[model samples]
Target: MKPADSAAVALLGLTVLGLAAPTAAAQVEPDPMVAGQRVRISDGRRCAQDGAARVSSRLFGPVVLRPGEGGMAAQARVAEGAAPGRYPVTIHCASGGASFTETVTVRDARVEGLNAAQAAGGLALLALAAGAAFWLRRTVGGRS
Candidate 1:
């Protein structure tokens, strides 16, 4: 197909995919990243009702839960001063309990940096698929 036809078909496919995609409320991806900006961490499990009296020293602040009912979540921040590498996060409870640790990566991002990565990955995939399609088309033509 011509370049214009190919581009139009691709655009139309994207339009359909966008319309068919699930709503934001259904997102189940781990909260490693949020708001296309801040990264978040949770124990992936709740703390005890009384809470962790002693939090690990490595943690930024006291691991406190939302004061109310439901699953208790200990909170910490991936601060702006924090490095862009992965940090080991551990939640310690004082009541002779086992602690849970999670490694959360905080990335330093500028709009241009993310844009470049997305564009590069998309182009690489497009190139690979176009090459495969050309090979398949050639094989079919040759066999016929």
Candidate 2:
């Protein structure tokens, strides 16, 4: 291929990769429970948040993470027919940055969803408050 053609192809390839990289990396379904909650975590290149203004790709692995790429956990991953152990996840993001991880003791254990525990606790509190309101209304009406 001609030099110009090769350059054009390379540019096209980079453009495609740029478009797809964010979709592939740091794409965790927004869990309201986890969002804005400061859980102990690490950052990586995949740390590019959804709808972020700037994103930086990174490597996730066992090593001290620093500012920039090749740093923290990008997203969750489980490969087919791969050996099991804690692997590093790296990420880099302009909007926000994070670096940390949880142990994958069992494969396919991490499912995305709201926390049942938090939801249940919130519901219980609401119930108790409702019961109290009913009791107060009854007492006030009887006194009047």
Candidate 3:
């Protein structure tokens, strides 16, 4: 083939691949999940076939991924007494015929609660100061 024709063919092939990329991307589902939460996996068109969902976790060995409508679902359970951190979770499926790595974050509920409480307390303190300032301005200006 002529050089110009070959270049045109290459360009056409790239364009086609780019157009089909989104369909392939739809095959991968949710990622960066919270520990112990069930999340779904997708190959875009349908759920993983039976006995096709396999999961491996750094902290929890051999996690089970159940087949569900549209995809496969798996819950990355944090190990008992494990500290809060990011852990790797690997998912394998037949539809995509590939493995994907997602991170599961294990956070202590108590710590989250405490952080929330601290934020609320700070907001309350600011509100109180604003109110006090407004009161002082009214009283002092009335005397002037």
Candidate 4:
């Protein structure tokens, strides 16, 4: 092969290897989490051997992260009044390791239509009204 062609091949191989290199990333489980719910954040790389790392976000506030299987894991409870939107979560290692950001989605807990409790209550009221009508009909008819 020509020198120029070999050089080009080497450059292409290097570029591919660089692109395939693994990078430390952070991710949140249960992407669309309801407000007041807890979510698990997983770290792709372990933090330095120092104190605990800090995980903070507008939805969940600051939480101390600990090293777990595969990487660091922490559970954060989203605020009860968090608005329905996407929030950025940040993980800062204690010993100045790489910091990464991940996004978490928060959704309103209340459903748009009637919920189970409301449906049950409505059924109870309906039954009571039916019973009252039956009693009135029986009593008035018997008297007449």
Best by TM-score: 4
TM-scores of all predicted structures: 0.41, 0.30, 0.41, 0.55
RMSD of each: 10.1, 22.3, 18.5, 24.5
Candidate 1 is scored at a TM of: 0.41
Could you give candidate 2's per-residue lDDT for residues 1-144 as a string of tens digits? 643445457556756875776423433222221212222223424444342323222222222323334433223223343343333333334445543332322133443555677789678667755665665566657752
Candidate 4 lDDT over 1-144, as tens digits, reads 643445457556756875898854777776668888877887766576456788878887778888777577788888888999888888888878778898766767643566566789778767755665665566657752
Clashing pairs in 3: 27-42, 27-43
lDDT of 3 by residue, 21-133 (tens): 65542222233334454444443433346665666666565755666665565544445655677766666765566776656455655322345556796776677556656
What is the model-wide C-alpha lDDT for candidate 1?
A: 0.48
Off by over 4 Å in 4: 1-24, 109-144
lDDT of candidates 1 onward, in order: 0.48, 0.39, 0.55, 0.73
For candidate 1, lDDT tens digit of each residue in 1-144?
Answer: 754446557666866875897543111123343223433334334455565433442425554533234333444544446556665666554466566655655456542234455779788768856765675566657752
Off by over 4 Å in 3: 1-47, 111-144
The superposed Cα distance between candidate 3 and the true structure at residue 47, in angstroms, equals 6.4
Error of 4 at 111 (Å): 10
| lDDT of candidate model 3 versus the reference | 0.55
